[model samples]
Target chain A: MRKIAISDGDIQVSTRQLPPEGPEPKPITPAAKDWMLFLGFAATVLTMPIWLQPLGAAYPDLLQKFAIFGIFAIGFNILFGLTGYLSFGHAAFLGVGSYAAVWSFKLFTMNVLPAMLLGVLVAGLFALLIGFISLRRAGIYFSILTLAFAQMSYNLAYSVLTPITNGETGLQLRGNDPRYIDRAFGVESVGLPQTNLFGIDMSGYPGFYFCAAVLIVMFLIAMRIFRSPYGLKLRAIKSNQNRMAYTGFNTRPYLLGAFVISGMYAGIAGALLAVTDPLAGAERMQWTASGEVVLMTILGGAGTLIGPFLGATIIKYFENIFSALNEAELASAFSFLPPPLQEFAVTIVNPFVGEGWHLTLGVIFMVIVIFLPGGLVEGFRRIGRLFRGRSGKRTASQAEVQPAE
Target chain B: MDAILLQVLNGLDKGGAYALIALGLTLVFGTLGVVNFAHGALFMLGAFCAVALNEALTWEIVTVDPTRTTAWGTPLEVRQPYLEAQFGDFGAFLVDFSVPLAILVAIPFMLLVGVIMERGLVRFFYKRPHAEQILVTFGLAIVLQEIIKSVFGANPIPQGAPDMVAGSADIGAWFGMAGSIIYPWWRIVYFLFSVLIIGIVFAFLNFTTYGMVVRAGMQDRETVGFLGINIQRRFTIVFGIAAVVAGLAGVMYTPILPPDYHLGMDFLVLSFVVVVVGGMGSLSGAVLAGFLLGILQSFASMTEVKAILPGIDQIIIYLVAVIVLLVRPRGLMGRTGIMET
Candidate 1:
């Protein structure tokens, strides 16, 4: 039997091609396979509210967060996963998107469509400016440059740009405002305005479905980008930028394009956040916020198409569900054991749950980075291989191509 | 002139902190070729070392005194610190000097933490990609900070300077200036202490045989390994020294800025800017860049500068970093082919 190797960036899976094992099987086209994957993903996401109920993440707010952060991670993955350029400031784009969307609500209308568009546009422009300067340097220099720009934006937003960002109180929808489009359309404001799509209120279940739809669309675009020739150039750059340059490929535009597109995705996610809750805060632009996206992208699997979304879901699940778990819940959960043993178990697990969920996240992230650099997808792949059996040679060959210093 | 001098002094005080933190960062980057995102956590740990020492020193001994009964007729409970009760005036002196004396505990403790970190976690990443190193270290940083949070309860634990140096001193009189320029005495002490630590680190690296081996390893690890030298051990030691420096800086900085769980993350970003401006893996560059940015920040915070450009101080360091990065990508003191990819 011969091995047929299927490669996705650094990850490779090999299956044995058995000689006429059965009646000649019809070949499945790559497009068909992609469609199947997309359908599976869509089904999983659409049914998250049902399947995630057991995990206590079925609520509207948490579902919306899952969708929003999933888009953020996917966008981040486009830049970082494809180009191997770790931008430590993508949260700036998210923040810009949020601010722009909120401003759109204040000045123009509360239509989610216009707000998302404006957010994407403004964030794209901001990314273009920052990326233009930052992409001049690569490696850690690039990371630092992006970090500085984000921090500068954050500082200015927090303190100096109060006229625009409303400083510490954050920009919020007010009862009195121009809302010119709403005024022009003769839509009377009776109370604080809620973001809507053609008069369909964007809150609770409807808001989640809206965000989920956008997330699905964004995922499709990301998948298309991943499979395109343009993606090939990005992967080439990631592998060896110097070689790509020597071969006369002006990589700046491609990198800038990826950066801007990803920025727009983050912007859309941010706009969705504002749409769901009509407020924008400068803290969204903080370095920690940027770091969260990075953590999500890396924890899922950087180069894989669906990895980031999965990572986002896991993290948001932990943030919302695990954090909500209190001592009473823990004791009840461990009540099967004797009283003293249950108490001991609770004490041991106490620091890793509730407000300490971040501690669990940190530990898990470290473990993944150390053992499974490709993130959860890699973990799944290894488990699959283990069950398949007699795949030692394939695994060994895979290890040879793994990136090392 | 007095105002300028005071700003300069304030700049120096802030610069001292930046320089100290960035120095350790640069040292680790140079020696191990590892970007330690947890360096700030080390500084925080150092500060907490002081807090822990103070807590241990002041373990209160409670006694019921029936003679001091309250209006409700319950006996009054009197509390005295165990150390003070035991050693009297000497114990009080020790308690007062706990912040400074934390250096004694922080050095060995931080060294152990550093060595354990290097041996346990960092060494494994030596052959991995820089991105992985960053992610792992960043995760480690979060874990460290979270652990600190769980222990300390998210509040800023105030650490006081000794009574002798708690008040402001008139430095303008000493300088023979017409106007009085009063500066906090603890800040001055912090500045001097940072200078001493920086000097010691520089001297150690430049003068010692072990440091020479570590420096040689930084230049080319493979070549040093071939030269029958155990450079890895020395690199681990260098990591330990770096931790010590950062820890001591944190220990001294508590009086100026109270120690909190998230303090490390706050300093991490700024110090990173310092390291980048100083040039990656350049020791002297880190120091020079640290002071330059700190002084510029101090000047930018001045009312005159603020009037000219609102909130320039908040972003001056980053602005300088951007300008320096754009104009000279190698940074102020960077060498060729080190992390240039």
Candidate 2:
């Protein structure tokens, strides 16, 4: 029997292929598979507001973060998971994107379209510059190179580029500053302008929907990339770059393309962050910020299509909900327990949540890395396999008994 | 000329800390093949050791004196540290020397912490990929930093040198420049201490049988194991030694930069840059690069240089590292193909 290897996102499965004399392998339609995935993704994202309420994550600000960071993690997964190249400096792009978006806001209009477009374009260009230098080296050296570049950018943003970045106070909207689009269009002054698309305000539910739609589009693009021939080359590069090199495949362009694309995605996410929050800070570009996205991607499942989204959702939930859980919330959560027990529980658990949320995150990430290297998605796959294997064995036994009869 | 000398001295002092930390990092990486991200955390822990010792040495006892009631009629409280109450002048002298004396506390604490970290968490990650090792260690670092933060609120706690070495020394007079150049006494001491430690480490590695085994294990782990030598234990001890070195560096550094929970992370990336630029697993290379980059950084921070290219000092090390790594992939002194994979 010949081995037929297939990959569905990050998960690879090998099946036995029968000889030509046997019945032909059942034909599978690629378009049908793509359509099914698209439909499922659309339904889940379109109904995020309705579904997320149960998880106490229906708020606009958080919902927007969920979508934005999902985009970021997905982008990161493309480079790291696909090519096996970990870039610690992706936050540089994310920060650059935010800076670009904020600049676009300062120069043009409050429209998020221009901001996002500019953010993505600028970030892509920056990524190209960094990726060119960084891609020259591989392994830990590559990681270090990217890190150094990102750090240089961060340090510059923090100190040197104070005029452009506005230093530590961050770039914020001003009443006196000339917004050219507002001038040309003769838009009247308001208290503080909100980011909008055409006329719809990007706040509350509207903002979440806008972010979700963008997330869906980004997810679709990621899915398309994962299925394309270029995607195959990326996977090949990850599996064996030396062999690919020997086979006359110039890997640099593919690597650079993936890096730029991922960087652009990060830029868009950064733009969305600014669109939702309306402020861009230098701290957004810090190494710790970059580390957080790495944590998200890894904790979710690196190679899987849905893993980044899941990871982003979980991490964002911790950042938003888990961090906000105070004594009162903890008391309410443990109300079912006796009063003394509840108090003890709150006291015990208090250190791992709220301001100590990072500690909890660190512990959880360590546990995940140690116990579940495949991440949360891998756990789901293990459960599925266990059940499927049991049922398949039962069916085979039943078929054997029928043949005996 | 004096300004240049001062800057050079400043660079050496900074480079000393970098070299010491990078030295330990290289030892751990070379011996265990695990990139101990928690290495910086060990340095922070070492500084905290000094802080802890200071707190312990200055443990105060308060007693209410009923005979001395004042103002609102509350009894006057007389406070005396137990050390002072017992030993008086000697206790005061001890408290003055607490920063230097904390080296005693740091060595054992760092060794213990290092051993536990290796046996407990890092042991599992040895056979794993570098990525996994990095992630696990990074997680441990976060956990460690957070624990420190929780214990001691996220603030820089200043630790001072003894009175004798508290202020700047007139080094210019010694050099015949006559007060044109003065340098901090503590900084000079720190530089000498680092040099001494570096010397001791090199001597230990070069002159000892254990060091020979370790060197052999670093070159070929399986072959050393085949020789029936317990290289694993030696490496674990090496890990402890590295931690102690890092800790000692941190302990001394508290006077320069106050001890903080995030101090580890602040230095970690820079230390890693130093290590890579020195060339991974290259001991003498780490030292050379550390001093080179350190001096360059100090020089870059000069008023003239900053005037020409603002904020150059903040990122000069990283910029140098990028250039060095791109131009010479094996680093300045790294043996080729060590960690190329």
Candidate 3:
């Protein structure tokens, strides 16, 4: 029933971590890197909302929401992309962070910074617990185990932890609960220097600027991690886990560490959301939510630095914006058309838009998987390669192959 | 004593559903090696089949005769013989006989769904990693559920048994019993019906020519193909059979628990854990694990146990799965050659 391996082949498919003794790859010059990053960021600052604001039909709302989700997906990609271990329970960590942040607002404070930190810390702990048990298995079995854990967390949150999570009623601010850190009524909170943190009055540009600052800081840290030696080790483990184990390296610690760190990143995003909304619910922890991020990462282009942002934006914006196009809205929009044409437009576009957004998403996802396979990022590179021919071929390869392998 | 007996009876009925769904899943996984994340959706489709049949059976007047009313003043006509005969006395009861009639009609549609799903979506993922297969099927299941929700709003549609089976059937006196058991008669009928269907499936797989081919194919698809047997056709038929089993389970399941858009998701996660703990591709193993897990869960929910622990019921099944995975990775009855860890 089996054949013995007489020799190793040219494919060199080693299931182990690469040797640590191998020459440590030279670091990118900080000056060149900072220059590259700053130039790109500067370009984005100039082009955003102002240039995107007048896209007429689409709205800057679309771009703004996408950026938020992109952050979520990017954090997730750090765990799944680098480690090659898919976590079905990652959403639990995010939900835990959200609940923590919201609870902070509910009990101690409305200050965004504290709420965000607490959310991240709580999510990190949850990830630690789950990863400790589940990381015992590998491949598909490991994924299923994590899945079971997530479902368990979801059920417990919805039903048993109803008092804490407020169950299906969802926790909302009715201006009743005593929030300790929230109100100065005059001075700005830590989140924004202009308004009170909780009941604080940091209402105007100050609050927006605070959130933007946090996003920029998070982006910088992520970029640093992406280029660091630690990141290279993570990729080595991802490619050949068993080989690493046999090479006298305890791969578990590295893998688990990456998982917890990524989970903390998700927590930060969750905290930001909760502090912004000041509410948390068990629905945030649903299995569907986990699936949503997976869709975002793959759809945007997994592993690429910028891919997660693009993916997250598409999904989140679609979620918020698409839901706005209700049947009444669709019907009303076609009102100026000819009677026959108006009725036809309503019937044809109705199912694929608005309440039918999930249908559109599922269709797009399937098409990408089958045709483009590498996702939106790949699709862009392909166009660029066509004109440059010999010169652009390598540029195209760098983008596509780097993200994939 | 009565409470204990009632709980045991309840457990058996619940276990019947668990066993049937797990059995079909095991059948698919064992031969086709698919985890079948959409199996629960198939079960939901089966329940909706009953709903479809119920809609189709709206009574119409045929040969209306004044004499048919007698004292009730309701115009009687020759309705479908099944509903007319079953609900002669208690026509006003919540149990719509149309749902029961739909069970038979739904089988063909369920089989078609099974075939179409496998050919259209599942076939492409056969060579892919298990995660990819799970992801794609999971997507399909969500789409299916949402489509159903959009079409029929997310509410638990109440479908009951026929009038005669609406309330408890007193088997009290037969076993030297003292009081009424209070078990719904339809549940009793459903339990017996499931056993019969399980028997038929077993016989079809164990004693027939098709069964022989499928069994051989399960062992080695390539060898079966090499031997001039059409493994693809056999797999299709096996899939059809698997779907029918799940559908029957769903149809009979209607009265016990009303069907809802989210009902499938609620059942699917646990059933998957069941299949895994039972061992992939082990039908008998799934049946054994299903009943055991069901009974254990009921015991976990008991007040006696809750006296010590507050939320024992929710974690019991998952805890057991973790323990089982640690102790016996291949499951108690797992075949040596099939998905051995």
Model 3's i-RMS, to one decimal, reads 2.1
- Specify the highest-lDDT model's number: 1
Rate residue A11 of model 1 by lDDT. Answer: 36
Q: What is the Å distance of residue B273 in model 1 from its true position? A: 1.1
Worst 10 residues of 3 chain A by lDDT: A1-10
DockQ of 1: 0.82
lDDT of each: 0.90, 0.89, 0.71
Tens digit of lDDT per residue, candidate 2, span A1-405? 001123332221122234659765554445566778788987897788889889888888888889999999999999988898989899999999999998888888989999999999999999999999999988877887888988999999989899999989998887765779977898756677888998899999899999999999999999888878888789889878999999999999999999999999999999999999878998999988888888999999888888899999999998887788887999999999999999999998988888888899899889988999888887887676578897655544543454223
Which digits, one per residue and each the tens of the lDDT, describe model 1 over residues B1-341? 88888898889988988999999999999988898989999999999999999888888999999789978889999999988899999999999999988889999999999999999999999888888888899899999999999998899999999999999998988988634799999999988898899999888878998778788888899999999998889999999999999999999999999899988888888999999888888999999988888889899999999999998989999999899888877789988767765
How many steric overlaps are in each model, in order?
0, 0, 14
* lDDT string, candidate 3, B19-65, tens digits: 78888988988778786777888788788777766654545335666
TM-score, every prediction: 0.95, 0.94, 0.84
**Each candidate: fraction of true contacts kept?**
0.87, 0.71, 0.24
Q: Highest TM-score, which number?
A: 1
Estimate, for each residue in A83-157, the C-alpha lDDT of model 1 and write its tens digit.
999999999999999999999999999889999999999999999999999999988778888999999999999
Scored against the true structure, residue B105 in model 2 reaches a CA lDDT of: 92
Better by DockQ, candidate 3 or 2:
2
List the TM-score for candidate 3's chain B. Answer: 0.87
Candidates ranked, most accurate by lDDT first: 1, 2, 3
